[model samples]
Target: MKLSYMASLAALFIALPAAAQPSTRPMGPGPMPVFADFDGNGDGRITEQEFIDARSKRIAERASEGRAMRGLSQALDFKEIDTHGDGGLSREEFDANQMRHFQNRPMPPAR
Candidate 1:
């Protein structure tokens, strides 16, 4: 009886972790994946090299799709958004620039 009880407890411990594991699936199509992909070093911050590489990859993808690749033109202007001139952007700085860009963009006509 004691052996059976020990086995059941062991099984419960193993199953709990498997059940608690976070889903590998994305919650939805979103920019979080883009940010994570660009963070090549797993350092939670993007260096200029990582940024450029990611941009190049994205441009290629867009070209393959026969899209105009309009966004790439401004994405590499790192100096403008670097703010502190540090030559690298933390996630905060990157997101700040995105917010600024979104805020300044002209609204489309109310259709």
Candidate 2:
């Protein structure tokens, strides 16, 4: 009886974690995965090299999805985004640029 009880307890313990996990993430677009690894050094700032590397990754991902991007335009260059002239892009600057870029893009009419 004790052995059976122990086995049952162990099974329940193993099952609890899987059962407690949420089935799926909430619907709709959440944060982009690109930014998660953008700051490679974890210094809370992105150097030009970091930006270029991350941008390349993003471009590759978009290409694979059949949505190839020609890359950043001359107007919105890295130095342009680095408003502080500190040679590093802060979180605020990155977010603002992303927001502006998305907002200006003309949307395709729905089917």
Candidate 3:
């Protein structure tokens, strides 16, 4: 009787965790990945000129739509968006960042 009770208690203890297990809530996808566009310098690193040029083009394009982006805001988001931590965003990073920004936004309630 003693062994049976002890075994039952142990089984109950083991099963409790499984019963109380947290729901598998999705964290959504992680930040986007980027690559170095290391221009054909053969040095295997992107140049400052390339970086500035890209920034300028983006500003021009987005600005035309009255979507002027703040440099400080972009930098803050850039630091977080560049998953590789290399301080520069590749095409992949830019696309994913845009995608997630749109997808993750809260939708307006139905009228």
Ranking by TM-score: 2, 1, 3
User: RMSD (Cα, Å) of candidate 3?
Assistant: 14.1
The lDDT values for all models are: 0.66, 0.70, 0.54
- Between candidates 2 and 3, the one scoring higher on TM-score is 2
lDDT per residue for candidate 3 within 1-111, as digits (tens), equals: 999999999999999999899644423323322334323343444344555555566556556545424322434344666677886556666667667665655443343
**Candidate 1 wrong stretches, greater than 4 Å:** 1-34, 103-111
TM-score of 1: 0.54
Each model's TM-score? 0.54, 0.60, 0.31
* Top model number, TM-score: 2
Q: Higher-TM-score candidate among 1 and 2? A: 2
Q: In model 3, which runs have C-alpha deviations exceeding 4 angstroms?
A: 1-76, 109-111
**Order of models, best lDDT first:** 2, 1, 3
Candidate 2 colliding pairs, count = 0
Q: Candidate 3: what lDDT? A: 0.54
Q: What's the lDDT for candidate 1?
A: 0.66
- Per residue, candidate 2 scores C-alpha lDDT tens digits across 17-108 of 99999644322222344444678788899899988888778667665555524323523778988989999988888888777776665443
**Where does candidate 1 clash, by residue pair?**
none
